[model samples]
Target: MKKLTTLFLGTLLFMNNLFAQDQGKRFYKLPIYGKYFETSQQFHRVDTLKYNTMPASVKKLYTNSAGLFVTFKSNSSELYAKWCVTDKKVGLNLTAIANKGLDVYIKNRAGRWQYAGSKGTVKTCEDGLILEHLDSTEKEFLVYLPLYDETTSLEIGVEEGASFVELPNPFKRNIVVYGSSIVHGASASRPGMAYPALLSRRTGFNFLNFGVSGNARMEKEVVHMLGDINPDVFILDCVPNSSPEQVSERTVYLVSYLREKHPNTPIIMIPSVIRELSYFHQNWNNRNHLQNANWKTEYNKLIAKGGKALYYLDTSSLLGEDHEATTDGTHPSDLGFMRMVEQIEPFVLDVMKKHNIH
Candidate 1:
């Protein structure tokens, strides 16, 4: 009877330990969407207001035969992903979908390439698609895949199309970035290779990208959404979306609103990258300059108002003196993106140190 009691006690303790371990494990349902496609009305529509202003290159890129790619980052040695894709009437098949894989390049660490062990074409199942990683760990990893066909919608998650398993919460000291098309990653060559993605990789932090192409006007709705997320740092990089007056008006209000809920949260304001020419040809050169000035004014105001947590990062020096970092005088090329990362690293590190989040 004594031996049986001892055995039962040992088993109970082991089960309790298992439950604790599982609870400490974290999972993230990262999102990946399919390529963009336009309907007939969108393709052939002629608007008198914007006629002849559209770039030929932009039109070409949006036409048939183009696709959008998505990337995922993970640290789990064993990974399982489930995704749901919508087949929007267009009858083309997915060309090929596989992990873009990762080149484990690290600072002061030897680089190695890790490939997805699974092979063959993956089809969207009724319950969604699943991909598994052979090994799981605490180190960071990147997953890249291309989306083809007329698919317009996709939902990705872990086992239940929602379960990510046994990984650290990189967002413990969250960094939320808000901006325009550049921040949304217009043309970064690969999905996960964008600057924000790279920054997440370097700093090992969770990133929430609130970049909407040509849509970041410091709108009230956007500010409200930003306030929903509790981030340690909030980065505003929306100079490309507003005129000087609009920027000034919204900056003060947005900052004030955020301060109301998160009195101690640090906010970082960034100006536009030095790029010539404009998408709308609306005198952006002067607008960008004034936006910077207004941002400084608001930043100083926050400082004076006993908000010592406010910070400003001048990104002017990021792309070099000649603005060589941009691809088409607007968006960043691969090289330009890397340089941007280099500039932001110091500021990020400072924030990390203050918060003691590695």
Candidate 2:
């Protein structure tokens, strides 16, 4: 019976592929969104030309299209994507779909974005249907690129005669978020479910992700590049990647440098969420405790020195008391990401509102 089931599934997929090819579709280049600088490449977060001295670790991760996406409008019965990623990397803690897959969201008539479809690529490049049997009405789409892999090329496919147009980025103001693997989207079920991505969808604002996996250690060159963006709000969530000593030594410099560059921009600092393993591991628990203390101490010192628009975001309640929010006791799973968004959305919205960022 298992052999028969496998055969049936394989046949179905083959037919689907054949059908997609038989339809004779037209492909158009998908324009990327969430690009902060004009690098030599399209999906890069930084222009390596100017900041040639950035650390090698940061230079490598900056090319991953974590927060990037593409938008378009189509009036077709189906949608397809043909794309390729640079490295096609895989993560032990993260799903391949979230790391190097495509997530599609369509805007309803009410102006709310809804998850419509998703597809994970199996090779360096694959052409497959993302969604079929649509209502054939004109509507907007937002397709989030890979969160951990760099998208080297992408094209959206629609019916040969159908109208398809790439839309301009809807979100105007940028809220830059710089952090560790959590911010880079470690264990999200899909790319769009990451906390910063969720925040962007919920608020209809551009929450640019600068998540660098294990590399967000508050380095001087990284902080300087962040200062160059000069966003409306700056969110620092790098505590997880930095050791307690690193946090103590770098927090002041990180905050002070940004303050010196953009004094009035709201600099929101987020300490690491409680790791479930820390509840049982004394060293991990102690390390996290010390890191939070140091982060808050630096914030207080900056405030004492009249640092304006600096706020410490308390995320102790992020994962809830159940402690089932992580995939590896470190990175948040989809449920954990949802909880994070729910807890974080209100505070973030309030801060942006007060500052009249809308």
Candidate 3:
């Protein structure tokens, strides 16, 4: 009787395990290779030749592609993703899916970027997480990767037998943005939510995000490297990192160096976005005014010389006067980032149209 009881228990355990495996068999998954698809990642993990040449400071900053994206086409009705992020802590105020997370945007028949679904970061020790499925008929899709986290590996899966094609990296001559933490996607809800990323999704132009956190001071080395990539437009949004003296001293050289290299390409100079701290702190307010004053002085000098390629954006109203745009006194919240996008959208569109890049 004891032997019979043991045999019955073993049989029940086997049946339960078998049932679980059978249930998992319903979804067919295939790995999407990084080599086949186009990625906005400027540096590959394994590409040491380029990595070795960089200054240690640059290598650390350039390794993260905050606003980069992937473009692909497939006949599969279902789209899925499995990604591994190196960071254990995925997000802060933004959810995991928006920070170290990835999201999907589809170009509708109307040619507008519309939200699909996202794969939120997983807490398990496993290297991968199965993402939410995007239900659709045959369509092309854009996958926006993480903003703040380092991606170790990523693969997109689809229906077992549908056709798949890798779209070319849309940017030949990219709109290269060099700036402060905002360009690095600091506190953005997701990678795609960054202003440069938004411009890409909305306008169908390719952008290379060169945001380097607080280190985006007018480093000449940074400008020299930026000159190598032929840019249709150069967005210099680095004012937050500079003081009025620094802006006054370095702004001309930085603009002139790029202007000389890419004479035809448009360059947009943005004064610092209004910091929330300025409202309460007199020192901060005075600094903001000084920087803008220095910037406007520079702009007027260029305009006097008929410098049509150079442009200026007065960012005093970026988040609007409601005074509810930031998470910290300096860094913008997701809402703040979105509002920033709203103001720049038309300006960029008009610039591209004028240059025939659109």
TM-scores of the models, in the given order?
0.59, 0.92, 0.80
Candidate 3 lDDT, 25-97, residue by residue in tens: 2233332222211334532311224435544655466655466567677766666665666655754555676
Candidate order by lDDT, decreasing, is 2, 3, 1
lDDT for residue 235 in candidate 3, whole number 0-100? 87
Candidate 2 local lDDT, 1-358, one digit each (tens): 9999999999999999877674779888866887677678888887766777888878888888888899989998989898898655578887777888999999998899999988876577867899999997899999998888877888889888999888999787989999988999988988998888999998988999899988889989888999898789999999987988999899999998998899789989998887889999999999988888888888889889888888888766578779999999999999999988887778888888889888
lDDT winner: 2
RMSD vs true structure, all candidates = 15.3, 6.7, 5.9
Candidate 2 ranges with C-alpha deviation above 4 Å: 1-23
Ten residues in sequence with the least summed lDDT for candidate 2? 86-95
Please identify which of the two predictions, 1 or 3, would achieve the higher TM-score against the true structure.
Answer: 3
> Any idea how many clashes model 1 has?
8
For every model in order, what is the number of clashing pairs?
A: 8, 0, 1
